[model samples]
Target: MWRCPLGLLLLLSLAGHVALGAKQGRVRRELAPGLHLRGIRDAGGRYCQEQDLCCRGRADDCALPYLGAICYCDLFCNRTVSDCCPDFWDFCLGVPPPFPPIQGCMHGGRIYPVLGTYWDNCNRCWQAGNHSAFWGMTLDEGIRYRLGTIRPSSLVMNMHEIYTVLNPGEVLPTAFEASEKWPNLIHEPLDQGNCAGSWAFSTAAVASDRVSIHSLGHMTPVLSPQNLLSCDTHQQQGCRGGRLDGAWWFLRRRGVVSDHCYPFSGRERDEAGPAPPCMMHSRAMGRGKRQATARCPNSHVNNNDIYQVTPVYRLGSNDKEIMKELMENGPVQALMEVHEDFFLYKGGIYSHTPVSLGRPERYRRHGTHSVKITGWGEETLPDGRTLKYWTAANSWGPAWGERGHFRIVRGVNECDIESFVLGVWGRVGMEDMGHH
Candidate 1:
């Protein structure tokens, strides 16, 4: 029963040696230069004898979950799981660590973990770790504290009446930005400090842009937000917050002096009272002085001339119509409801995303806000999904979000930005002048 042939035994032995030799050869090729492929058991740990490389405990620890326990010196190592293999960190870690924190804006990509959070020092805000743009304040607090200034009773334009109409297939420009048309007109982002006068700041800025564009560069006035915050209290409650419509009406009625005449103090209150008196003293006091007003300290009377917005009206909900208005009229003011996640936006087209798991409640829904819609464009994603975006300017300083501007998902009334968009013609005439 046990009769064996010498030929059969020889064949089996040859096959085993051939298989073992093939594995050894493959390992030799993979080993680094000068490293002899040999079996070794030194103090540190087991060396992969076949590959002539040290197999650190981490590699063996991760072998069962990732590659099999058969360790090799190939590209199968994961930095997250086992440092032995490179470039497999994301694949093995499941949720890997994020990129090292850096300055300014950054796109969320493979390098930056989708689960890590970062802080934006320039704007004094924190961002949830994810693939979305990061802004300092979530939409809610930004609007509530900075933008929710419009009063319902103080609305000057009748919102119920729709003014814009869409002609079917109206071939609009693919992109439109006020800054492009009038580069010198776009003012730097204004800082509201601790006050919630975004309504006043944005309104004044819109007026400034319009005046510059409409006058064909003849009139470029940095209309005063302090004037609106200090004097326009009849409808608005001072820096406590005012409505855009109300601010526009006030500008039309009483008008406002230039920032040249009244410098911005960041704070809305004067030490004397809750509302500060509009200092009519024309002088080169604080920053933001132009050559025209550089030496015009004695020209107080000229600086006091009130600037107004004429024929201010509401924009329609139609996206194209709004874009058309921006192209034709210049920058317009729009109210946006800020979601909680909006505050962490560093850069990129902003959209709402759910709060990351285990994040604080601040990542939840916040409040309403206002911004100047400067331009619009369509962006195609890698997956070929096309998204329209509104290039909106924020009052936050240039250090924040795309040099003081942010792109929000457009067309679908993102954050209700398309709702109640307001446009105005700055009252520019020969009579509007400042004596230096």
Candidate 2:
């Protein structure tokens, strides 16, 4: 359910299992020199090797139609080929084939290669009738599609002199997590569905976390991204995507009701249809002074249900300063760019690399995205280099990217994550006073 960019939406919509359609070459009955077809005789999926064929192991079985035919091991074939024997046969004969698109990785392994090619069987693409998903788009195309509308300076705040003052002991822990230290304050990971509404999701999630943490859990409540997506059309684009600045600005000025009052509809559709028209009920609830349209039913703003953010400001790019804010207040929203290999990420610390498995065109920064920065940590690599990482919450469902969370290389401003961090003060309630 991880959201893709607007431009990728069209391409992602077209991704699917393309038929290789390699005009079935004539099948050969006689064995050729240095060719060994294993598992064909038994058909029970056993391995056999010949010295001339050079089968590496059990999986390298050259069986059936691939045994003698000049099988076309093309890119699509490598992705969707029914038999594993052709790959083995090609390898034994010194024929190089493109790497498979989809790969497996241990849940928490330290070492995993980033896959280059698009996943041939992405469920999202299948659902959308597309041949690929986010991984299919090139870096430049993704960047232009996703970040084309973002305004850089809009995220900058004037609070540099205030939170940048990091004390010696409280600078930053080697590792920290808002969810671990303050589970009550951390909201659950949310799914943006197929829409590019990550700006709204991340902004609302960070604000919700900050509200709960600042109020010491007394005023904990899940804020509504639907409210922003449906009602904040003046400065923000609903499903076509929006900027973090505009989302925060909407929260500060217009305010929003709880999710119960303005439930999310953008995610209800798996196809990620266009954003629904601004609901009359939500619009009336979000506006401060505007009276509810008398003819519109259930369109009144209630003081008890309404919540507003005050003094939303951007944080400096300093890593320790960002950590200090999270430790003191709560999670902050991070604007970032992503690479294609990110789709293959399962777990462990992630850092962008130029290539994966020696493929020079892999892992390029493909698109812009936003997430909630909840924690920070450091890990020691085998080479003795200290790898600092940031724990961020994704808009995709918990089924993806480490249970809806990911750790990226930190301190060096990887993917511009350190740049344009934003924080805000949530509306305080009377019930929260005693708790704090």
Candidate 3:
């Protein structure tokens, strides 16, 4: 008779039987001289089982000859190469085997293990614990909710016939600022909130500056965007979005009131809510002008006079012409393609980046946005390169980029900003100045 080891005898004594469920046809098979094993299958389709093969404590003898290879039945097997038999968990430990090792996450033709992360420029992409991957919000949402200027028709875009004549003998400065030239004349930037009404905001801002500058600081009125949002409804979508041509047309024809007279009510509780009713209206006062017909929305403000501007004209895409127009007049209105990354701008000369180049189409969106170009300057980089930039006023408020203003690459028509530059003259007559 083959003598069982002391450890095997101890295990068999505790089991109270030589085999498991012999009455149910579960018989022990002799594999080696003294080793009797029960039948079970592993992931590799090899037969394995827990007989008296488990090590009592930490012995190297707790292994079985499995298909010409050694498969450990010891507890130490879990800490090493995990070469334990499949039934070692069920028969020895009374538990099911753990799930198979999860495969790595695949993206952009690369495999990333769970919890792996990588940064695509400013955006971070990572794999989650549940074997899934996640990327940040789509660019479409940023364009739809944050920016609101619609692309102008080709006719409007190509209407650059009206150019600002440069002086033959005069020399333009390397850098110039409208606010510095006419202090207290340029209007500070205003917040458009969630409203996509850059059309109204930029129009009103540029008009306000021109009105003040043209009047020699006599009539410094911050024009109301709410007046245009609520009243200028012909082919306009209010907060949803609108065309700059329509905004300029309304400023030239229907006219708008001062912000003090009719404050901005474009910020809705929900972005989809309807704009407030037209609180201020005007009646034709002859000479292609108008006077306020309704009382000022802000009752405290008694100046209900309607502010108007001359017909807007486009400026040539030349940087000198744009600079000359901005310096000679006040700020000029410009249409730019606001890319998804623009919203992350804190400071510096802005330009569209290729960070989202490998991203999906939905993550690389751009929308038209209008802004006021107030000045231009050049910065010397560490690499001895000079960066020319335009200082422009945004409608996102003062707490944002560079105190409600931003600088963008100049001369290259970056984001089509210089592609459709426009300037206007405030309808400041003798009577308008006398009132101030």
lDDT of 2 by residue, 1-436 (tens): 3334442321221212232223433232111211112111111111223223324432222233322232232222232323333344344445532333233232232212233222222222211221133443454544433332254453243435345786666545688888888977898888776566888888889888887877778767788888788888876777666877778778877666666556677644333456676653423433342222222223453433556777777777889888888887889888887765555455667765434444354334467788899998887754555778899998777866777788888888987888778888887756446733
Tell me the spans in candidate 1 whose CA falls farther than 4 Å from its real position.
1-144, 151-162, 166-169, 267-273, 280-302, 356-365, 430-436
Poorest 10 consecutive residues of model 1 by lDDT? 9-18
Local accuracy by lDDT, each model:
0.58, 0.58, 0.70
Best by TM-score: 3
lDDT of 1 by residue, 1-436 (tens): 2223331211101000111122344343234221111111011122232234433322222321111113333344323332232223233343332332222222332122222333211111222221122223344445455555563443443565346665777788887877887799877767665567888888888998888887777788888888788767666766667777678877776667788777676553232355666544323322312122232223553545456668578777788878888888898888887765565465677766543434455435456567888998877654556767889888766756777788888888777788778889887655444433
Which stretches of model 3 miss by more than 4 angstroms? 1-138, 269-272
Which is superior by lDDT, 1 or 2?
A: 2
Query: Across residues 1-436, which tens digit of lDDT does each residue of candidate 3 receive?
Result: 2232331211101101222221222112222211112211223222235356654344455666442234556675554235465556655677765535323445455433222222333211111111001023235655765577889988887775576688799788889999899998998998887677898899999999998998888889999998998888888888888988899899988889899899987665275565788888788988988998888989899999888899889888898888888988889999999976676565677777645566567657789999999999988754556778999999988766788788988988888888888899999888777763
Q: Please rank every candidate by lDDT, starting with the best.
A: 3, 2, 1
TM-score of each: 0.61, 0.65, 0.69
Which TM-score value belongs to model 1? 0.61
Residue 100 shift from truth in candidate 3, angstroms: 21
* Least accurate 10 contiguous residues by lDDT in model 2: 37-46
